[model samples]
Target: MEFSLPDDNNNLSLTRFESMLKTNNVLFFDSNEFENIIYHYLENGKISLAKKAIKLGLEQHPTSTNLRLFKTEILIIENKLEDADKLLENLHDLEPMNEEIYIQKANVLSKRDDHESAVQTLLIALDLAEVDEGIADLYALIGMEYLFLDQFENAQHYFKKCLEIDNEDYSALYNVIYCYDFLNDNQEAIVFLNDYLNGNPYCEVAWHQLGCQYVIVEDFDKALVAFDFAIISDDTFVGAYLEKGKVLEKKKRYNEAIDNYKITLALDDPTSFALLRIGKCHEKLGNDDLAVQNYYKTVHEDPLLDKGWIAITKFYNKKKNFQKALFYINKAINIDGDNVVYWKLYAQINHRLNFIEEAERGYKKALDLGNYELSTWLARADILIALGEYEASILNLIQTAEFYPETAEIEFRLAGLHFTLHESSKGHYHLKNALLLNTDYQYILEELFPNILKKPSVQQQILNAGKTEN
Candidate 1:
């Protein structure tokens, strides 16, 4: 959407402009020449040069609206919105039909967080746009404004309008798909991408997106075909290869997934993702040595990739090598201490090694980092009970019950903890609730509170519940 001069003319003008600046001589250039020089400076990010060019340009051609518009743009960039607005108002009076002026005005309004006013101004620019590219740009701008407002439907409509004007506008195509994704309309996205591909069959981006939509909808076969077509359209497309590898892995074609993943390595620099996936495929296929090699390479290529380290740790853990698992998980945690998955895995490995206090601390850190899953809560509470921290276990289970109310497991655990704490009244209350919810899980009571289960009153209550169920 930007215009640039030919290389020769651009170079000649730049040389002349520099010569004039160096000699402190007034050089006269027509409005078009000055505009090109200023554009060149702006495009190359020489803001001071651009400012000087604009100053000299207006001195020579004071009535040139284009040069003044450039000045207004710089004002907007410099956060002089008031001055930019004043300049735009004057420009609009001089040339009410100038679409660029309205566009610049919309830029200022968008910076001020006035998206509605920006969209209105862009609509005016759209109406004034006489060329296809300009109209498409206006549509994209309007779509972005609607996105800022979280109006996905409206954003989709405008971006689709942009595609109608230029079917090859990949930016607009991506935005249209993003809106559909935000609205959770994968089927519509698939249908739209299919229609788009029917016209532009060679668009790798659309084919790649279609594959992802199929993945979301769990149509693995269609996803595979889409990714294949994407690769055919652009054989060196790394994303297509990666998606195809994922689909193959889901289908349990581990060897085939490795083959496809290795293709990505040959086509470009080795990626940690591809290496990790290949390692997993090898592990699934019982290629332990190859799996270990790739896993080590994965971390070597990018030590910051926590998944690679976790993968290594899990592999060791699966083999009952607790020491090695603990070592790798420690490395992963060191790299990304805030990852809940790493903390949870750290807790599990420590627990396996009978390092109860460390395990408890790991679980507590996991919980603090927002690992609120039922398994994590139960593991932490169980660890606390093992450490004989009955009060802490009771409080942990109490909080877990808040997230998972009316659950027999939590209720049973709470009854066991209260009984262990000698809060017999509270224990009986929770025991009754657990039995009411699910008498089938009373085994939890037997497992955690066998002594309580032996009590005559508790046994009779459970017997009464069984008789009531019958």
Candidate 2:
């Protein structure tokens, strides 16, 4: 009833079955043909047609276990678990050695969240399974059951067992790595992968996994070597190239990283990640033209790539082109209006362009979207102060200080705000605390509070703090 369609020849069978159905001669199909027709419909997600096929198949072959099993599977899909269980139990009594019945029963138990019972049932299926045909699949199912139970070590053991049976089981191998990651046992993963590589030296996936583990442990040198081996094992491995680029980028080898990223472009279609990295490397190397070119290409390739827009906006901001930066950041916000980072960037650009009201509104939007950065709060406070809302600015700085209690800049700003509002005592108190936190922060007083710093009392207090620090 549930047969694997391993090759394109199954398409021919499906076509012929469709022809029969169109001619209204589906009744002529034998049990195997009818099962194939039912499976074809189910595989294509045509459940109604599959149900009709199953009914016709049962009418034609009244005692067919395969057709009955297919009906039970349909029942399970319909959430008729009780009926499915009863039918599977009857099938088990009729054919005690049939592995599919046990697998089906395990499926029912799994759906019911009885994973332990499911594992036991799968074990029974394993015991009766033919060695060459279904053993690997059984091992995989047991591994999944253990994963469902959050028993990562047991899952890893069974997945490893699957790999031993078929060395090409990439899914099982990846699951083993996932288990290691869940346990935070990268060293054990390294050791196991080293052993795996000893026997399977040319497996690109194993080498890639080994490289990832090395990266996790911050062993970039070993990671580079592993990624090199992955590329050597499969010359067209785009993942190896991309990961190698990342490690080289981490080491500040920008040119080498670009080379690896370029190799991925040659091996496959360009990805936003690779293009963005290449753009960043160019930006780091001071190749502004090339950086802008790649950034444009990145957004063109993926209009929704927020980072691409961000990179372009930051580039323009660095060049003191506030208008251009605002343009690109607005495009980014249009694509994803709720992104906190985009809103923050928009606020900063508006602040640079002297649009105080828009800047304040942008800052509020960013904070509402969960941007709690100290710099964001400080920028908003600056805007409030510029608007002569001293009390509102003080409230903003106080909220920021609550989050970053030890930051001298916030205290200095708060001191300046209190001085502006004629709260002399509070101003002196915050100034003393700011000097206690960072004595040299007085150097920014002219920039932050030029008018207040000119007062003799404030100047004398700063001078006194400087003498105390000395």
Candidate 2 per-residue C-alpha lDDT over 35-74 given as tens digits, one digit per residue, 9 for 90 to 100 = 7778878878999989978887888898899999999889
- Candidate 1, RMSD to the unseen true structure: 3.1
C-alpha TM-score for every candidate: 0.88, 0.83
Best of the candidates, TM-score: 1
lDDT of 1 by residue, 284-318 (tens): 99999999999999999999898899899999999
lDDT of prediction 1: 0.93
Give the residue spans of candidate 2 off by over 4 A: 1-12, 40-49, 75-83, 89-97, 390-470
Task: Output the lDDT of residue 96, model 1.
Answer: 97
